[model samples]
Target: MKWMEKVEHMYDQFTVREQKILVTMVLVVVGFVFFMFAFFISDAFDERRERIRVLRETVTLLQKNRNLVQESRQAQASLELKAVQKPPMLQGHLDQIAKQYELSLNFTPQKPKDLGENQEYQVESVELKLHDAPIKNLMQFLDQIERGNYIMMITDIKLTTRRGQPDRMDPVLIVSSYYKRSAEELKALHDKAAEADKGKDKADMKESTKTTKDDL
Candidate 1:
C-alpha cells in the first residue's frame, strides 16, 4: 500500500506530455496483446467449426448415396433372377405384326451397317404400295408401326394418283426408321448372364445335395 501510494504521487508529479506518452505506450502494448489473443482464438474456433461442418456434410452425402446403392443392389438382384430373351426373332415378329394388321405389305429388312460411335443410322423402311383402299387402313398401319415394340418412325411420304387411268389410285409411302443396339446389346449381355445362371444352378444343386444328406 505504501509503495503504490508513492508511485501514484510520482505519476501525478510528471509533466502532461510525459504522462500522455506513458499512457499511450501502455495502452498500445495492452491493445496489441489483446488483438493477438483474440485473433488466435477466433481463427482456432473458425477452423474447428469448419471441420465439424465438413464432417456433417460428408455424413449427409454418404447417407444419401447409401439409399441409391441399396436400390442398385436390389435391381441387380432382380435382374440376375429373371431376364428377358433378346434378339427377338425379327422376321417372325414382323410377320406376326403384319398379319395382326391385315396389311398386304412387304417387309424388306436390310443388313445393318455399323454406325460410328454416337452416330445415328437408318434401320429399315417399309415401302407401302397402297391399293385402292380406305384411309382407315393407312391410319391403322401407321398407328401400329408407331406403337410397336421396336422403335419405328414415319419419315418420307409420297401420294400420287394415276394421271389418266381412273379407278386405280395408289399412294406410295416410303417411311424411314432408325434402329439402335438396344436389342442386340441385350442379347450380347445374355452371354454373361448365361454364365451367371450356370453358377447359380451349381450353387443351388450343392445346397439341395447338402439338404438331402442332412435329411438322410
Candidate 2:
C-alpha cells in the first residue's frame, strides 16, 4: 500500500499525454526484460537436452563394447578363422548348416578387407540365397550362427514369396563376420610401424643436436 501511494504521487506530477508515454516506455522495458530471460532459459534447456542425449548414447555404446569386444589375438586363439581363404571355408561351414536345416542354399562371399589399424578384427561378408524357406527355420539358423563361437552379424535381409508357390518364401541374407588379421599381415604392419618410429627418433636426435650447437 505504501509503494502504491508513492506510485500514485509520482503519476500526478505528469500531464495525461506524458503519463501515457511514460507508461508505454515502462511496459516496453518490462517486455524486453522478460523476452531476454525466456531466450536465455530456452538456450540453456537446449544445451542440457543435447548433453543428456549424448550421455545416453555413450552409455549404450559402452554396454555393447562390454558384451562382445575381443582382441584380435584372443579371437585367433579361440576360433578357426581363415582370413586368406575365407570364401571356401565359409562356404563349407554354411553348406553343413544348410544340409542340417534341409534348406537349399547358395552363397557368394565378398573379398575380406582390413577395417583399420586400430580395429581388432577385419570385416568379411557373405550373400546368401535361401529358396523355399520358412520364417521359423530362418530364425533357428540365425540363432545358431550368433550363438556359435564365431562373431557374425546379419546386416541385411529381404524376403519375397516364391513365384507360382505362394506358400513358399525366398530370402536373401547379407552376413558380415569379423576375423583376426593373418599372421603375415600383422607382421608386415608391425615392421612398418617400427620403421616409422626409427625415422622419428632420428629426426628428434638431429633436431636436439642442432639446438645444442646453436646454444654453444
Candidate 3:
C-alpha cells in the first residue's frame, strides 16, 4: 500500500520527458502480454473447444444408435438358435434339396471354424462345384438353400465356361452354416442318442419274445 503511494508521488515529481518514457515502457509490456494471450493462449483454448465439440457429436451419434444396437443383439440370439450344430448334420438335408431341384451336387466341405467369441458356437461351410445345370434348377436350388429351415448364407458364387463346353459352366457356390455346440459337446450328445436308440431296440426285442411265447 505504501509502495503504491510512493509510486504515485514519484510519477508526479517526474519531468514530462521522463513520464513519456515510463508510459512507453508500460505500453510495450501490456502489448506483449496481449499478443501472447491472443496468439498462444487463445489458440490453445480454440483447440480445446473444437475437441470438446467433436466428442459431444460422437456421443450424440452413439445415443441415436442405442435402439439399433439392442435390436441387433436380440436378432443375433434368435439366429444362433436356428444355426446348425455341425456341417455333416446338414449334408443329407442339402442332398434332399438338390434332389428336389434335379441338380447334381459335387460338394467340398471345409473344416469347421472355431468362433471363439462364443464358447459354444462355430462356423462350418461347404463349397459346391457345379459342372452344369438348367437355369431353373440352379435358381430353385439357391432359393431352397436361402429359405431353408436353418439360417444360412451364401458367401460367394462365380461361374465360368470351358472353351470346349460352352453350354456347361463350372459355378462355385459357397454356403456357410453356424454351429450351436462345440465338437466335444456334440460328441457327448451323440453318445447319449446312440444309447437311447440301443435301449429302445432291446425293449422291442423283449416285447417280441414275450408275444411269441403267448402265441405258442
Residue 143 error, candidate 3, Å: 3.2
lDDT of 2 at 72: 55
Better of 1 and 3 by lDDT: 3
Give the best candidate by TM-score: 3
lDDT of 2 at 64: 81
User: 87-203, model 1: which lDDT tens digit per residue?
Assistant: 244445444655665655555544544353533332545555656634556566666655544445565666665667554446666554454445567466557679999999999
> TM-score for every candidate vs. truth?
0.34, 0.44, 0.59
In candidate 3, the residue pairs with backbone N, CA or C atoms under 3 Å apart (3 or more residues apart, or in different chains) clash, namely: none
Q: Which digits, one per residue and each the tens of the lDDT, describe model 2 over residues 9-50? A: 999989999999999999999999999999999999999999
User: How big is the RMSD of model 2?
Assistant: 13.3
Look at candidate 1 and give me any clashing residue pairs: none
Ranking by lDDT: 3, 2, 1
- Candidate 3 local accuracy as lDDT? 0.79
Name the runs in model 3 displaced over 4 angstroms.
Answer: 1-4, 12-15, 34-78, 84-88, 117-119, 162-168, 182-216
> Candidate 2 — what's its lDDT?
0.78
Q: After superposition, how far is residue 37 of candidate 3 from its true place, in Å?
A: 5.1
